[model samples]
Target: MQTDSKWGIYEPEKACPNDWDLFQSYCYYFSVDESNWTDSKSSCQNQESMLAEVVSTEQLAFLTTKAGEYGSKFYFLGGSDIVTEGEWIWTTSRTNFTVTNWTPSAPSDDKGKENCLEMRKGAGYQWNDVHCDKNKTYICQRPLL
Candidate 1:
């Protein structure tokens, strides 16, 4: 059997770089460099991946555990309501986000200015709505192919 992902179809037996971490059915790269959401996405794109998408609490937990070592900082996620505020969607996955781990009172949209989604270490890696222009570290992910 085969599976289809945002990156199209691929086999799962292949390996990612020795430096990259493999979790579940995907390969992840946690970037230490800080950049605005757009630049972060671009950086991931250059690496043939996209800003990490939180598909499940288990995956989010894995990312959070790895992220803690890098220090507390916001990390761009693959979600945004930039197209229409309040309508969040994963830009890379092109699917409506069915699950999320947000801190209490989050996604407030902050005066209706925030459109991008980021994971805040201080909030225990819960999702936070932020301005797309805010500079932050980021994570990238691709199917394990």
Candidate 2:
């Protein structure tokens, strides 16, 4: 079976490369300290990356857990409503991934006129909708080989 140790991820042997290869998949992790929804998305694009598009169940769990390490310091994910209300989709793609990390009763309406998606560092770092103007840290990622 593929092992997390092989990539020095389980124990984090050191400051691993931003582009970490795991289970035949390349994972690049980047973060922005703070930015508005649009700005955050733009930043990732400028970096040739987009707000992380988590593709698998394991990947979503891993990312959500890691986000909690920051403790109440919310962070944005790749999902947004830049196109239309109630049409939440990952910034990297048009359709939502099969696995989602949103908490129960979350994303309640486009209330607060939220145009952004941020993670709440609790209960497995689940997701919550927030105003696009709210400042918070964010993650951006891209596949690498």
Q: Name the candidate that leads on lDDT.
A: 1
The best candidate in terms of TM-score: 1
Q: Candidate 2: RMSD over Cα atoms? A: 7.1
Candidate 2 residue-wise lDDT, 35-120, digit = tens: 88778888878877677776788787677666664454787888877688877787678876466777797777655487678877
**Model 2 — which ten-residue stretch has the worst lDDT?**
15-24
RMSD of each: 6.3, 7.1
- Residue 28, model 1, lDDT: 91
Q: Tell me the TM-score of model 2.
A: 0.73
Candidate 1 deviant stretches above 4 angstroms: 1-13
Query: What are the models' TM-scores?
Result: 0.86, 0.73
Full-model lDDT, candidate 2 = 0.69
